[model samples]
Target chain A: MNNNQKLERGAEDIFGNWMQASMDFWNSMTGRHGGMFDPAGALAQAAQSSSDQAEKMWRSGNKMFQLWFSILGEPENLSSFAKGAEVLPGFMTQTVQQMWESFVEVHKQLLSRSTPLGQKAPASDFTQPDLNIFRTWKQIYQKEFQKFLNVPQLGLTRVYQERMQRFVDEANLFGTALAEFVRLFYVPIEKSLDIMQTKVEEMIEAGEFPEDPKELYLQWIKVLEGHYTTLLKSPQYTQVLNNMLQNLVKFRNARNELIYDALGNIPIPTNRDMDELYQEIYQLKKKVRELSRKLEAKSN
Target chain B: MNPPKIAVDLILKKLAEDTEKVRIRAQKASEVLLSPLNTDIATTPHDVVYQEDRIKLKHYKPAEVRYSTPLLVVYALINRETMLDLQPERSVVRTFLEHGLEVYMMDWGYPSRKDRYLTIDDHVNGYMDNVVDFIRARHQLPQINLMGICMGGSFSVMYAALHPEKIRNLIATVTPTNFDTDAGLLHVWTRDMDADTLVDSYGNMPGDIMNLGFLLLNPARLMIDKYMGFFENIDSKPFVENFIRMEKWIFDSPAVPGETFRQFIKDCYHQNLLIQSKMELDGKRVDLKNITMPLLNIYAKFDHLVPPRACELLTQKVGSQDVEDVCLETGHIGIYVSSKIQQQFAPKILDWLKARDGSAKTQAAGKKASGRRKSASKAKPAARSGAPATAS
Candidate 1:
């Protein structure tokens, strides 16, 4: 237990505490019993945690350098420099990769078990129509592949390249998860909102009072709540949710003809028809009198 | 100086004077020679019935006596009435003439500032009635034909309803009846216009402002493409001449009177009252049912200014049993000027009028005859009236 050892232990303790706090923040924000977290609050927490970790890491690294300088007598040494560079790169790489992997795995598990807060699927295992799902799926897959090409081979040495390659291979698994989230979770919720808005407008125009206006309003709110829940449970669901909402709006618009036809309040045609009918009755009466005159003449 | 030099100078001066005199004489001779050609070319055979506010009614001589009825041609106030008889080859007025129909067209001249107060009622009731009466009196006919173009078309429809007995045949070309529909940008903007503010500020709505609005409706195509097209075929003299003529016609817009502008927007655009049969011009109910005369509604299919939908509703709303809607494949201006219209549409209109020539007598007999007498008398009084004779 030298000073260097004390610093290293302190760094480990700080990292552990930060990771715990980060997890706790995420749990509170997404917890069922707890009120939904404001997006601003979540963003602030993420930024604070990342900054604290970087600060602690820097302080510990400086302390370690001081301790090593005291022990070595000479400041310039190839082995010391190489060790500093080599060990930290592997350590940091492992830490970040583990964090990302754990986050993704937890997200998947949560999505699988949880239903959106205000909405349930019509039936268990019920899925949205797969009309344009393939288009989005292809786009996501291509984007993920391009992201793979962009990942830096995090190595100044040959041995590090092997480590980097392993990380890249693991990152590729997120692609399928991203695509599934977009198709299944995000799209359906968005489409439902769009449909709800359209229905409300149509109802208003048709002059049909909603059975419960509050319930109609709640339906709209439920869509937004469902979107947030899906987004929290699986971040990749945002794109699909937007697509669904657009489709729902289109569907709602298509229902206007039905609503308008049922109302039957447009004034032009009914008036014209009435006029025509009146004219026909008048003509009929005139014809009857003419026929009676002809009969009278024949009888005479 | 040499004797020949002096003689040469004197001879040259004499030659110049002689050349001047001969040139003058030649000019006079050419004027004399071309005078009859110009008169024949310019003089539309249509007779002038009534003149007021620089607007003259040209009475059309019928080819045959069928129904003692008159057809009034309400040309758009924006252009010279000569467009109805643009040329013998392509004259809408001539077609009506050949069809043995009595036609009366309004020639709206360039209105000076003083003439700006002329309202819609003044044109419809005062001028239009007078022309109708003039025609009625000339042949002792009971009713007259009413043909309106563009703005005039809308005016004619209003007039026909207000004085329904006077109109034997109602022909409206490129007429806008429904202004609420988004069939054209003009309809959409005009539908919500505050016309009172515009009319009150400007006694007569400026023609340039109207022209600018029309240009903006299809800015890229109408403003740019048309000019570009002119430059492309500038070398051909006939093409250039026709292009200049069209350009001149397009720019020659008349100031719409204040009250007329206000009523047009209120009745036709804002309220969409005309097509709805809810409009009242001069306290008289403008009911389309009142327009029970034979209506030959002509509209252009590709008219960007007035869509077919706008004009098509007139046939549906009007009470006429013999309403015939002809949708010509042309633009707004093209209804009058397009070569295809000259070849097809103009002739068809004449034929339609020809078919209904005999039917007018029966229709007018069913309706009031006094309305016809009032309009017919207007035509006769211009000739009989001893006011300063205006150009008809």
Candidate 2:
């Protein structure tokens, strides 16, 4: 075969191989090959498959590179090279479309599980969005993005990066805990509202609705108060509150660590430095008081 | 049987009347809001006699001192001492002063980041001891009356135990000595709290956070009904002023010293050591038997912060035979601020203090305590196990 013809064939083969590799990675990720929705397993499989496919693509790529160098050296075969590159955009579009479709499907699945008030729907066992919202987000975060943060760092900024990562993780955890805590507050409000609705409906049915609207408000508030009292004293509420507090403390400590590092660059003292000084001063004062008291006793 | 006929016209008329009333009220409220207001708190005149770091000794000397022994009032670190003298009509300090008693209050000024290391020992042994000694020396008396309010009362109990010779009478009002009962939400929630983590994260427990916690204790009443009451009477200048004053006092919280908070929660709430006489400070056990001075333990019956169950056990555990507990039908702050309850509370304290004032028995007790103080280099933990009181 002529040198130009050989170069064109090599270029086409490399494009085909690259497209196939991209399709295979996308397919594995979207579970089109019929496997459970295990992101970690899928990722491992995709990595292994891509490595094997990469070797073949690399060989073809090398041959194409050599052929292109030979053909392009004679300036007349450039149009053929340009023509072979036209397949790439279509493959890129297809991969993006598959990813979009998969995301939509996942979103639909998450949305299908529940009702807004966390009650079970008669039609299906789908949990509403508000129910376990944090858990859902946490699951996605741990599976998809947490590993990126867990990646080992290099060079002099390693400690700084690690501290940042810790702060970020703690902050996320605190946010989830706080969300749960806030959800408890809403529970009383929701239940009160539901009660109010039924009471009003009953009143309407009996034609005994109060003329004074303030009475209704007063009644509603009493209902709300009752619910809140029950909720505030509940073990579940206390557990959520403690969880939030603990998480908040962790977040604050993590944040303070980063601040400590940052403050090292500035002239201002950090809490740790000030705390040490305070401790010494406090001890010194205590000793002075003790000594003074003893001296007074002896003098008396 | 047929249902009662709906009166739509009556409902509409009532709604219109309510709207008109609201509009009129809003107009008057706007005028009230725009006008000058005297919402200032802690306005009772007093001089700062002694100062130690953030701690200050306030002397509220009456025109005529009825009692020989000056009463030193130690307030909690969680809030300002201003709650006693909230208003002219309902002032506890004024009542004490009018009854011809010498009053000294400890103003635990807002603690800063540096104050985080200050512990319960520092408060009781350091500041409180110095204040008591200063008062005793200034008044030329060997012993003074000691009264503590709420958390301050807890400190007073500790102080009276450690330095019984310096205290002729010990009055703990709305104070929490026992921590085993789950009668109050504070007792319940604090039992599980990681106070070390809280204090460590925020050097001194943030005042705003503490206030938020207090609000959570009764959000329905404090958060909702209280404000609703305000809107209902927004046009009344007097009501508005009092509401604002109370609001200022309630929200004006100070950061509790971190070490003190950690020790309190751990030693008292978690371990239930205070009433058990197992609580130790500055290497000395707070033996309740050492608190042999005339003890008057007063607590609010409806106090959600320091329930009666927490305070009632103190009189039983103490070494003094001359012990009395007055349980008032009031809430925590209500004991001080409620106009109706003020008559019962402050007068009751005055009478109790008066009855104990310079009694021969009290003097003998003080002398015995002085001997104990002179002989003992340190306090030994009490071995007697007192029966725990059930929550009412």
Candidate 3:
């Protein structure tokens, strides 16, 4: 075979392999439950099918690199190949975007199916708040594109690309921390409030005393408020506070009677010397007025 | 299993006899424990103690009023009014009496189911108006000092505003004037409550339901945590007694009249009309500006039900030139019963009233002295007029 024809055949083979490997890697990385993409092979299955897909994608990527290398060797035909090469980069970009969109759609479907029907539909539950997958994929694509740009000796775009990726990475971390906080801390405290309210109602029914039932309940709220106020000082705790406040309002509305009934029969002890007491109270009032007037005069 | 059944039957037979003995012992113990706490105000020990509509109001001689003006205490209809005179050490009524103020507190008798249709107008203008007239006529006094507690405080504020001429001084304790604040769950719920359903379903809202709602507001401490503490402290006789007393009081809820409840929720909570000076009671505009008498407003700072916000608004809303606002650092129930209030808040309240009275007395004395000087100076002018125009 002629040298040019051999080079063309090698490029074709490498490109074909690269496309297959990219698709496999994307599927493995995005697949469910740590993705075991290969079901039949016991050894591949043992590692996880997702990893297998990634491995296949990696091999395909190597072939694409080889094809690009082969094309690089033929400087005379580089102009003819430029058109196709330009299309390939655009195609990769489009494909990555499509993959991210598909991932979000699937994530939403899974979440909806997993959530119980009884709970009040949370706004966050409709769609995953964390869009880290798209963010990270976009970063990787930008990085790869920058490498392509470097091949053409364009150096300035690399700085902008890195800065953009760093911003996205920080945002993704923040979003992740917020979601984790809501799930772990906020949700549990909200549940605790519910449990606490139920226990209070039970105690009232059972007849516990010394402290007024209403006052006792107030103390509990004060404690909860203190905890939440402290929690709100942290950015991580902000999301939890939001969730808890929402739940608290709902809980309070549902159990409004518990608070009302707590003050139902406040004991008023009226066995006293009413005449003498009134006189003393009246005398005290006289004294307070005198003190106030004197203070006001002094201030003036 | 059969052997166990046989053993159970034997145990059951023995327990049957033992149960009667246990019951008798329990009954005796209950009798002994409850005897001290039981105050049969219904059936007075002596005939001299007369009952007016099943409430024991103190009887006074006609001559007594000539020396001292009577103080009439108006208690909230939701609970018994006995709280003012609860115990000798902490009784507000006792404090007044000790200061030589003739005290007359209205004990709104236990409202029957038929009384559910009664409205705020009926209580304030009807029953309350009649009681005031009765006191006035009996004492031959044109006006009297009015002290109100909780819901009664609101009623008293309304009455004072409506009939300014009839009230000498007004004292409101733990009284809520503003319902829009977020200081308490009651304020929030009441602000947005649908009173129609509550009032329509039950002619009078059950006190138990109200109690339950209050308990739910602070469940952790009110429910499990409180009982755990109670059980731990049950060994102390005084603590147990106090606990039982409070429990009994907590559970002994009185049903609120439906119409009154409806009006209170709509006019006070949802509309927030009271503090705005736009509330109409009995077709008369209750402009708080009309409350020009000396006013003493006391509230609990830590009160969960009626926060300081609810009570302090009274001083700001009323047009009384001599308005006193005192905030006690205690919860709602504690305001009335706490030893701290007895020592501090109650005494302070008494002092405020006495100071007003003292200034008035001094003014009267100064006028009398001036009248004597003028009469001696212009003896012929008094004879010419033939009308004894002494300084009032």
Whole-model Cα lDDT per candidate?
0.59, 0.79, 0.59
Q: What is the TM-score of chain A alone in each candidate?
A: 0.24, 0.61, 0.29
Deviation (Å) of B355 in candidate 2: 0.9
**Model 3: per-residue Cα lDDT at residue A112:** 60
Candidate number achieving the greatest lDDT relative to the actual structure: 2
Error of 1 at A52 (Å): 98
Query: What lDDT score is found at residue B92 in candidate 3?
Result: 57
Give me candidate 1's interface root-mean-square deviation: 37.3
True contacts kept of each: 0.00, 0.70, 0.02
Weakest 10 consecutive residues, lDDT, candidate 1 chain A? A30-39
lDDT, candidate 2, B252-356, per-residue tens: 788889999899999999999999999999799999999888887777777778888988888878898777777777677777777767767788778767766
* lDDT minimum window of 10 residues, candidate 2 chain B: B383-392
**CAPRI-style grade of the A/B interface in model 1:** incorrect
Query: Once superposed on the true structure, which residue ranges of model 3 sit more than 4 Å away at CA?
Result: A1-190, A193-300, B1-67, B358-392
lDDT of 1 by residue, B52-160 (tens): 6577876667667443556677876655566666546556667666666666677777765444455677677667776777768876878777788877888899999
Q: Encode model 3's per-residue lDDT on B148-191: one tens digit a residue.
A: 88888899999999989888778888888888787675675555
Question: lDDT tens string, model 2, A1-300?
Answer: 999888877765665566556555654544443233223566766776665565556556655765555555443455555665667887688766765765665576567744344552222222225546666666656655566678888999999999999889888888888987887677666777777888899999888999988888889888878777677777767777899999999999999999999999999999899999999998898898889889999999
Candidate 2 TM-score to native: 0.80
